[model samples]
Target: MPAARLPVYDAGPPCVSRAVDAFVRMGMAGVTFGAFMGSYDAVKEGYKGTGRALFVAKSAARNSLGWGMFGGAYMGLNCGLEALRRKRDWVNASAAGAITGAMVASTRSRSGIRVFGTAALFSSIATASEYLRPVQYPPTGL
Candidate 1:
């Protein structure tokens, strides 16, 4: 008797599609963060009505741009590093994210502490996410 063969499946979506999806997700996250921070800042500064709304909108836009750029750079760096090292690791991703976070913080304030703090926060989050990622195991024949 011949042995049974497992079925092969087609790979889902192209690389570009995956990249676009990731970019959109990161952009949305940035917008949300910006909206919250902007609203808080506006309130702290005593903004009212139209002023608050306008501030929030502007902040959201700026954040979207910053996050989109960060996402692109992070992905690019991760891919490039992986290609060179032939392995995927969180160091590249975290470093890219940290750099972008510092840049964003610098735009918001001139304090060195704030810039480094933001970079550290972002890198820590990235590392945590990487650590908590789901592991996939190959199927075992029973």
Candidate 2:
């Protein structure tokens, strides 16, 4: 027979640590994406420029910085929501994602449609991911 009660897992209080860790991890992904996209851009130019290599490097660095900033912002919002709501669940992730998406899009254009579109896109992605994530079970007493 199943137990009548379920054990709770204490992940500790919400702190800056989770945000910082997430930022670094996502930042690395940004770096990788930057490297590849930059290379592709350079290659599309038919390697005709004397500064092709330098162009690739600059593009990579710039893209990486942009993505890294996005990651930090997204995670910071997530962590803040988690702390404020006193819950660690998909609601937080979805909200954070929507806000972050809107913020990022607004940087380029202040159009309502653009911001709202991105917000919806991001929130959906976050919610889907949260739902797809595996359930975390409490540790065994043994």
Candidate 3:
């Protein structure tokens, strides 16, 4: 006799999967923002100019550059994860943001610590919102 065909469960529907995936992406978003902030701070401190003009220019340039770099890095990391891990990208991106931001916060004075901590808190909330109200996409069994 032929082997019996096995039943395939739908893995709890696309909605559930998508919701979980969004939550994961939301986590990544927080990390990415944090990492970005941390990196920005590190970049700022790397400068060694004591002159006012050079210092001012370096600070401004560092801020702008950091923002751009962090944005790119966050997207790239999350996209790469999505492609490779076959998971939701937003959560991964949010996590990356948080990590980067925290790292940036770690490399600062006490005042900076307070500031970054506050930023992290707010960013986390924002990320959570992203997860709950995710940007829709075709479900991918994530």
Best by lDDT: 2
Off by over 4 Å in 1: 1-18, 90-128, 135-142
Q: What C-alpha lDDT values do all the predictions have?
A: 0.70, 0.75, 0.52
Look at candidate 3 and tell me the lDDT of residue 97.
58
User: What 10-residue stretch in candidate 2 is worst by lDDT?
Assistant: 133-142
Please give, for residues 1-142, the per-residue lDDT of candidate 3 as tens digits: 9544323242223443544454456445644654566456545767443454455544455555555544554445544554455565456656655665664455564577665785476457546755774344434445
What lDDT, from 0 to 1, does candidate 3 have? 0.52
Task: Report the C-alpha displacement of residue 140, candidate 2, in angstroms.
Answer: 15
Give one digit per residue, the lDDT tens place, for model 1 in 7-78: 323222333554565677778988998999999999998999999999999999888877876776555554
Higher lDDT: candidate 2 or 3?
2
Please give, for residues 1-142, the per-residue lDDT of candidate 2 as tens digits: 9433323235443446656666677777777877788778878877647677786777777777777777778777877886677677999889999998999889989999999999999889988877875543112342
- What TM-scores do the predictions have? 0.59, 0.79, 0.39
Best-fitting candidate, scored by TM-score: 2
Cα deviation at 101, candidate 3, in Å, is 1.5
Clashes of each: 0, 0, 39
The C-alpha local distance difference test score for the whole of candidate 2 amounts to 0.75
How good is model 1 by TM-score?
0.59
